[model samples]
Target: MEFHSNSTVFHCDVVGSDAHTTVLLQEAVDALAVKPGGTYVDGTFGRGGHSRLILERLEKTGRLIALDRDPAALAVAQAIDDRRFSVSHNSFSKIQEVLGQFHVDRVDGILLDLGVSSPQLEDASRGFSFRLDGLLDMRMDMSQGQTAAEWLASASEAHLEEVLRNYGEERFAKQIARAIVAARARQPMVTTHQLATLVATIVHARGRENKQNPATRTFQAIRIYLNQELENLSLALPQCVQMLNPGGRLVVISFHSLEDRIVKRFMRQLASSDGMPRKLPLRANEVRLLSRQTLRLVGKAIRPGANEVESNPRARSAVMRVAERINRT
Candidate 1:
């Protein structure tokens, strides 16, 4: 229940060569405006790519706290021997709770890189990619919950269609779900390739796209639903804003439109005073106190540069947004 920093990480990518390349590395770190002696949080530690960078910007007096849900990331975090840094094994949605456990009241900044990491895609056993043949297990934390295979085995055709449509935005969700139901009656939905092939069959016949894998949206849909990624993000944003010190930054890097939509709306809502009640003809100071903004939108959404996208194609979809906490004095 009380895991130390060295124990794990938040949902994020891998480190080292052949692992995840941290997206917006310089831009994200720079947005944080790291103060050598201030405290900060890397909400999604992944493989410590961002965490490591944050630590480098910190002095011995400064502190960095990190979180990740994947145990694999926990192992990577263990290698960090710095005394000023600590990590936790938990979802980013639990940021407030984790900070409490760490005895930290507020932080100067928080950075969240949302979406699948390259290590997850490359690891066949994790079942994140259709290109890789492995067990159909896409649980972000393999130890915690149901795998994609298990869900597919038990989920009804209608429910499967809903997930595909809502999460993946697949146009032919209904047909694909029907095919899955038929296929499962004959054999178990046990492997990534099996499901990928099945989905591709349906997609190829009706919803084919040449540039992308036919089953790409299907895989993404299942993973998002099963992992409850969007829900976690929704829960985490308010907490991130609440925990920031005045002028502290909240940086989020989202990989898909859905995730970005949630982030954008949340940031915009808090940054605008119109979201508050304004009926009372109260005094200026009183109105200010009652309807003060909690966040101020920073620069425009940042995307990976052309060179970065070319070198790491996965970074192409990334969109980073920044918001700074407002001092309500």
Candidate 2:
């Protein structure tokens, strides 16, 4: 999946009829408030689902800059032939630098569909799905960093436990971590099923909270830690806020509680402004607002409609939050 030539236009297609549905597609794009002839950024680009819609809403002069850490996605992005479109092969965390390269100081809108793309999970070769017996590789950017298997093989018990508890929110993190360490000492922990089985064996469920697979949390923890999903997200959020033009929108679709919490807190703090105390204050109309309010939260987090979720179960976990940049007086 190599992308070459800036002039080529890509018409992305589903390789199989079974390609995963892009969760919360319309809602995320609508939140962008996309306008013709305005520059926008689709930070995750995945299969160009959101990107194509953004381009359609733009006028001839309007530009859309799409970024994806996955080379596979970049390849699809490169295949698109519109002169108004350009693709960057970089993580959204490097948003500032990548946008700077194009002399794009500010954008009309930015959209981040955070977390793993569907292809990364559906493709057995990518090794992201626990349902398949593939390699334990889960890096969004395969060109760099350690695979999940390598990390698990050498990670300390304490560090593994911390990741499981913090990222996966699994109560049996300590036991799961111990199991992995002990198992690896006997033989290198490789392959998805192998690790999954190890986790299931150690995490016993005796009570009512026993329906879900025991390996689910442990796998999620490893993937999140190895990919640094939360850290990357934290880095990207402020960059998105800083890069938007006045009245520009930032629409984020976060799949898990941690990501949603970060988005919620960032927006709440921005909206509240933590204004000065009403010390010796004048009338309410005469009061001056705080100096640094940059963002205004759009609305409450949006979840998928029941019909959409029934069609694509992956859509069930998605939550979209939107915020708009304010004009600095």
Task: List the RMSD of every prediction in angstroms.
Answer: 3.9, 3.9
lDDT of 1 by residue, 1-329 (tens): 12464333334333433366998999999999999999999988888788888889999899998889888877787667777877787899999999988889999999999998889899999999999999999999998799999999999999999999999999999999999999999999999999999989998888466888899899999999999999999999999988999999999999999999999999988887634466666667767754667898999999999999999999999999999998643
Per-residue error at 69 for model 2, in Å? 0.6
Residue 218 deviation, candidate 1, in Å?
0.5
Where in model 2 is the C-alpha error above 4 Å? 1-18, 205-211, 274-289
Clashing residue pairs for model 1: 5-87, 9-67, 9-68, 9-69, 10-67, 10-68
Model 2: colliding residue pairs: 9-79, 9-80, 9-81, 10-79, 10-80, 10-81
lDDT of 2 by residue, 1-329 (tens): 22222333334422322244677888888899998989999889888888888988999989999888888887777677777887777878888888877678999999999877778887777778878888889888888899998998888999999999999998888888888888998998879889888777777542315657777777777788888888988898889889999999999999889889988898887767545556655546434455567888898889999999998878888999999998553
Q: Which candidate is the best by lDDT?
A: 1
The TM-score measured for candidate 2 stands at 0.90
lDDT of each: 0.88, 0.82
TM-scores of the models, in the order given: 0.91, 0.90
